[model samples]
Target: MTLRIRSLLEQVPDRLDQERFETWLETSALRIERILSRGHATPAGEWYDQPRDEWVALLQGAARLAIEGQPEELDLAPGDAVLLPAHCRHRVSWTDPDQVSIWLALHFASDGTPQPGP
Candidate 1:
């Protein structure tokens, strides 16, 4: 299914929506996911560790994604996607506060495996 976004003011002034990291795939073989949300606030000094690399795409709305040590900001619109180098540290900075974001995340080893590394 295609990701879709809708506009509505976010509840938190610092956040876009009520974020739900609905799935981690941290336990599965293929991917991780952030379902309907305004956005996610990963800790400043912490990083999300997956056994495999990840590819995240904005299926619905716009998002501001930031890699921990990178100075660049990622502005993603619907259909936009990013590939996180394995073990890359990053977090979601903001989402379109006026809309709910639908994201699809996938994780896989560099060896071309469709699922996470064994």
Candidate 2:
């Protein structure tokens, strides 16, 4: 198979009616995704409880994240990142309303370690 080269920031959609999620890569125990958000947030009284650990980085625009049991919300700008352990409840409080927010997320098994690809 021929290898392809692509740009992560290219061809972004003009309108984001809802949050966009694009899977970049995946293995048996790991997955990588690119997310685009425009003034989007998790629903009130709802939280994400995932079985795997997640590491997320903000590449552009801005966002706010709230972790369960934490008093302060995490304000993220370009280049900010957070690592959430398995089952750690969290939610997106807000995202930039005037511009699209770009994010890179890595999801791995519950062990909090990245398994090597075959």
Per lDDT, the best of the predicted structures is: 2
* Candidate 2 residue-wise lDDT at 69: 97
lDDT by residue for model 2 over 1-118, one digit each (tens)? Answer: 9999977788787679999999999999899999999999999999999988998999998999999999999999999989898999999999988999999999987754556533
Which candidate tops TM-score?
Answer: 2
- What digit string (tens of lDDT, one per residue) describes model 1 on residues 32-114? 66556564555566667656788887877778877877889888899888888777877777776666778778776777545
After superposition on all CA atoms, what RMSD does each candidate show versus the true structure? 7.4, 3.8
Provide backbone clash counts, one per model.
3, 0
lDDT of 1 at 58: 82
Candidates in order, TM-scores: namely: 0.65, 0.90
Worst 10 residues of 2 by lDDT: 109-118
